[model samples]
Target: MSSLNFNLQEMMTVAASRMLAADDVCFVGIGLPSAAANLARLTHAENIKLIYESGTLDTKPKTLPLSIGDGELSDTALSVISVPEMFRYWLQGGKIRTGFLGAAQVDRFANINTTVIGPYDAPKVRLPGAGGAPLIASHCQRVLITLRHSKRAFVEQLDFITSVGFYEGGNSREELGLRGQGPVMVITDLGILEPDPISRELVLTHLHPGVSVEQVITATGWPLKIDADLKTTPAPTAEELYLLRELNARTQEAYAPDGLST
Candidate 1:
């Protein structure tokens, strides 16, 4: 077969990778979020703490976990505790530095809908409702969301709000006395977004290399916001690409030894 294409999924992973810091305590979800967190840990930010919702704290698994409950998370964890204490003591108690999430749909206010597509009691698409997103969003020092941006995925209003973003608009999160950093960045396949200083609504800040503002607007379901001096997302550097590839190779080798070759 020809060389595999790295589509939006890969782009999402790349986007998520950039949000991590050198020693952030990240509450990571599975899928793209997991890939990004692991890539960051192996690459530029080796000391970043990985926490799973299953109560594993400061986990340092050599391989990518299959889920939050993956045995490897517990096996390699610094410590494990009951679910209640993990949330009440560590997360809600303000120990987590960041929460990495993925969304099916997000609105201008950044309110997320992982719950459903249509109505509440009756719905067109009943999605996987929030498991720990509400707590994660409310308690983490900050949040980073990764999603493929499209008219459908980036909507004017979410079908059901599973996690509060800016929470009704303009510093409302603080007004309501919600503790934590809130959403500092939203990473998409097309670009990076930050909330307006005044409105706290999501606005386009940087378009990825080869992506245009017009294309981003076209993909958004609502009237998108754009700053006067929007920048271009820097292309992945040689070092970044090399490290990411190596991380992927190691993860594949460890997780799929029989299926993946050296």
Candidate 2:
């Protein structure tokens, strides 16, 4: 497929989608994370169990959900449970394998900040506070973070740490007894970042079709590390693109202002 046919967001979503396996149980977050998780379900990970914080279990939405509470989630879900059961029994009990998340700001260690952009007391941008992300990050067996790559979003220090990713890096998360392994992959428009085996700091492991190592480094707020054996992410396949575009088109139609499909 020609590169022009797909944009960076599509590539990012596809790359993130590929991180899941058919047998995985994914705890999904909203927006980009939700899109990537659903794309995985529609394509490679057909049997992947998708659970939402809103208590929708095994949801297979034909169209992307606008929020956790979106009717489409519950409508297509295998079953609906209470939020407490969703978090306590399923999430904290270690039933979740992959935690798909998005963050407003992410530090070098993959520490997520979705609270405030500036300061906690008086913020430049007040983002939606952490929902189930903290528990999702800490309890799931592993996590996959997806967001646009930029110096602002990829920060040296977050305004506030809403979800712990490796905490202070290294064995810090282990020290704190966080059950999950923390973020295993951080997928972005430019490429993929993985935590170093020893240091636990995020490092550039793969670059997208047209992205460069310098571009990834420049986009990061901190002094990013480059893997010794860097790789290029395979461009989105025709089937992947077809499924993603179809899903998006359906979403637009479902949300059309006149309640009509254009």
Candidate 3:
């Protein structure tokens, strides 16, 4: 295996998965977050419990579940509950350690837009509306956002705010009566962004291996902030890549035999 697997999607997933730890009890959503969380479980953080909104608790799906309701998830779960109980007891009860979710569009404050692409009244691309994202963002202990980084996806402002991140910053979530710590980190294809402690703004604190700072700036729609002491992300290790590919193979064979790769 090549030490330099410049596959951006694979790199991004690997980077995101590293954020998990053995003790974490994560609330995972579909797509990138799902793959990343599953990768974490398969490799290093085997003890990281995964909870899906479909009421699956501690799901150990062999492949990436098609949806929260995917039987493979429930089949491997430690226990299953109804949607209401899942929300009331785990998420709203603040038992979830991290809410790992994806976003269509994101801003400097980390606010997400998964509603529409154009004006609200009459829009262009109509995206998947907020499912449990709003509440999950509100009550989880902390949130980790995953999205592809492009000028279009990383917008100056959202067309419709699907999930609030920092809002207007400075204790805004508290003011709005929303619990949780809001967004702590945003993992993207280009790099990793984390909130600045003082400003609560997402700053470009790290760059993916072989990616330039200028490239990240160019991809961002807004004027991105740079950390004075930025870090360069380590290239994916052979073990990490191997495990990720194995996981991708499993999900593909189970969900998309036609030829889909995570």
Candidate 4:
């Protein structure tokens, strides 16, 4: 790919990497979040602790696992425990530093809906229900969500609140006896979103290269905030792109060689 034709997935990876710090204990999900977390682990944040929901703690996989239950995740993990211990003793016990997740739908308050698109009794689209997301969102020190930008995915109100964000706003999480930073950042294909200062609602913080404010607004179902002097997300450097592609290629080779051949 040309420098100008930056891949959206790669951009999301870059954005996700920026959210992590060295030695962070990340509760990582599969797919794009996994890619970004692994990229961060291999690149700048070598000491980053990777925790999978399948009872793997501080896992150092050579490549991405196809899912939480992938044998490689266990093979390469530091240690594996019972699922209950993983959540009760480690995650909910305040051991996790960050929780990274992706969403099908996210609202202005950073509320996520990964379960359904319409009413509970009657339905439009029944999405995959939350696996460990609600607990992760509640217990992790902070959460980072990633998704592609579109009006359909970014709704005014989610059909089902699978994971809590601000949770009725105004420090209600604290009132409800939940601790941890709700959603620190949301990395999307269009831009980066952070909580609004006043409302604590998700607002556009920065736009990716070649993306316009109007484009972001058009894609969002609700009105989005824009800083007058918003800066564009820096294009991925050649080195960054090279590392990301190599990582992806290695993952493909390990998990789907036959799939790639076709």
Q: Which candidate should be chosen as best, given TM-score against the real structure?
A: 2
C-alpha lDDT score of every prediction, in listed order: 0.84, 0.92, 0.90, 0.86
Which pairs of residues clash in candidate 4, taking residues 3 or more apart in a chain or in different chains? Answer: none
lDDT string for model 1 (120-213, tens) is 8899999989988888988888999888889989998787889888889887888878777688888998888999988988889988777778
Q: Candidate 2 — which pairs collide?
A: none
lDDT of 3 by residue, 1-262 (tens): 2456658788899899999887799999899999999998977898899999999999898888877789898999999999999888888898898999999999889999999999988899999799999888989889999999999999997889899999987777678998888899999988999998867989999898878899999999999999999998887889999999998888788765455546
Using TM-score as the yardstick, the better of models 2 and 4 is 2
Predicted candidate 4 versus true structure: per-residue lDDT over 101-146, tens digit per residue: 9888998888889998878868898888999999999899999998
Assess every candidate by TM-score. 0.90, 0.96, 0.95, 0.94
**Could you give the candidate ranking by TM-score, starting with the highest?**
2, 3, 4, 1
- Model 2, position 79: C-alpha lDDT score: 98
Q: Over 4 Å off in model 1, which ranges? A: 1-8, 249-262
Q: Please give the distance, in angstroms, between residue 115's alpha carbon in candidate 2 and its true position after superposition.
A: 0.2
Give the 10-residue window scoring lowest on summed lDDT in candidate 4: 253-262
Error of 3 at 1 (Å): 15
In the order shown, what is each candidate's alpha-carbon RMSD? Answer: 3.7, 2.2, 3.3, 2.8
Q: Write the per-residue lDDT of candidate 2 for residues 83-155, one digit (tens) a residue.
A: 9998889988999999999999899899999999887889899998999999999999999999999998999
Clashes of each: 0, 0, 0, 0
